[model samples]
Target: MSTFHLKIIAYDKIFYDDEAASVVLPAIDGEVQILTNHEECVVALKTGEVRIGTPKGEMIPAVCGSGFAEVTSDNQVEILVDTIERPEEIDIRRAKEAKERAEERLLQHKSRMEYYRNTTSLARAMARLKEANKYRH
Candidate 1:
């Protein structure tokens, strides 16, 4: 089977670096599937889950914040995101607290700017919690 090298990096760390048979990323517009030597392109990423299929047939899943992905014609895929976390690494309690805080802020803040920030935070926290729980088994 054909495979490609995939590197996923965040601001503070490298989340993954390995050979993958395929990858499904949450693009800003929608979900995108990438395979070996697919194409050369760049796309914005939304806050969601990224699923990677390894050569050994293992599936690795990660939660990613907003970012971008670059795909090369030579089968190199680089994903740079604001934040990335594995399911096991995430603290469900912390994510829940963050979500509550954001919700509180959303209710108390009347300014549009504050509302937007709180809304985004709430969305991100919810995404993290949901993704983390999905892999708890």
Candidate 2:
């Protein structure tokens, strides 16, 4: 069995740090899975779920804002995002409110920059809501 050092960090805190067997990240193109000794490269992440597989084969689920990840040649994966929230940590009511607020702002016909900001907010909010509700069913 093989593994890699994985670190997930955000502005406020470190979400995770340990050795993992694999990780699945949400990329703009699509979901990407990185295994131990995977290719060394940088990947841009989107507002979606991040799945981590530990050495013991336990799966962890989380959601994060748009960010980037760097994979070192020596089997080190570092993910830096603005914010990361585990499913259990997310406030579903707050996320729903955020989604509604972003939707309302989009309808106001703001400037281009404002539109982009609202759009990003909506995406992030939706992502969080989806993650929070995933285990409910």
Candidate 3:
């Protein structure tokens, strides 16, 4: 299969940089798959799972926070997200605690911005937990 340059950058570090056969992203509208020579465009991402298909046919999975992806005309794909972590890297206990905190915050009610923030936090925590459990040994 053909491949393209895929670079995934989290706020703290570069999560991935190499040739990829494909990538399935959690776009705002829905899951978007990008293969080699995919159309040049940009898409908003939500807190969810990211599946990266490597040139060697391995599928690397990750959970990512909200952000965006840009596909350049040169067949290069770049994903910039607030956070990204592999299932093995996720701490289930920490994610569960974050979810509980977000739920508590939501129950208190606050400004619209605060509510939105809490909801996003909850979503990210849930995504992380789900991915981690799915791949748990």
Candidate 4:
């Protein structure tokens, strides 16, 4: 069976380290699935979900921040992200509060820099909320 070693590092933490049959990344262009022996390349990721396909065929979802990834020629993938949050690790209440704060900031008249900062924060909070709620049902 073909498999690849994957390591995801974010915010000074080892988010995930293991071997997987496949992994889907939220690249800037779109989602990209990497399989064993996938062509070596690098990509920029956005604020979205990173799906890992375990050997047991289970798909684990993780919310990740903007960053970049590199797939080595030896079938190893390394992803360096600004932040990462597992659905179970997210504090919904706190995320909601952050979302509210970001929304309020957006509503206020601000300089271009402030607006962009708030917008980024809002996007990050929303991404966390979305991942946390996905499995609620």
lDDT of 1 by residue, 16-108 (tens): 998999999999788999999988999899889999999998999989999999999888999999999988999999999999999999989
Per residue, candidate 4 scores C-alpha lDDT tens digits across 20-41 of 9999999999999999999999
lDDT of each residue in 65-129, candidate 2, tens digit only:
99999999999999999889889998899999999999999999989999999999999999999
C-alpha lDDT score of every prediction, in listed order: 0.92, 0.94, 0.97, 0.93
User: Candidate 2 overall Cα lDDT vs. reference?
Assistant: 0.94
In model 2, what is the error at residue 6, expressed in angstroms?
0.3
How many Å off is the CA of 132 in candidate 2? 0.7
The candidate with the higher TM-score, 2 or 4, is 2
lDDT of 3 by residue, 45-97 (tens): 99999999999999999999999999998999999999999999998899999
Off by over 4 Å in 1: none
TM-score of 3: 0.98
The ten-residue window of minimal lDDT in model 3 covers 84-93
List the candidates' TM-scores in order.
0.94, 0.97, 0.98, 0.94
List the candidate numbers ranked by TM-score, top first.
3, 2, 1, 4
Candidate order by decreasing lDDT: 3, 2, 4, 1
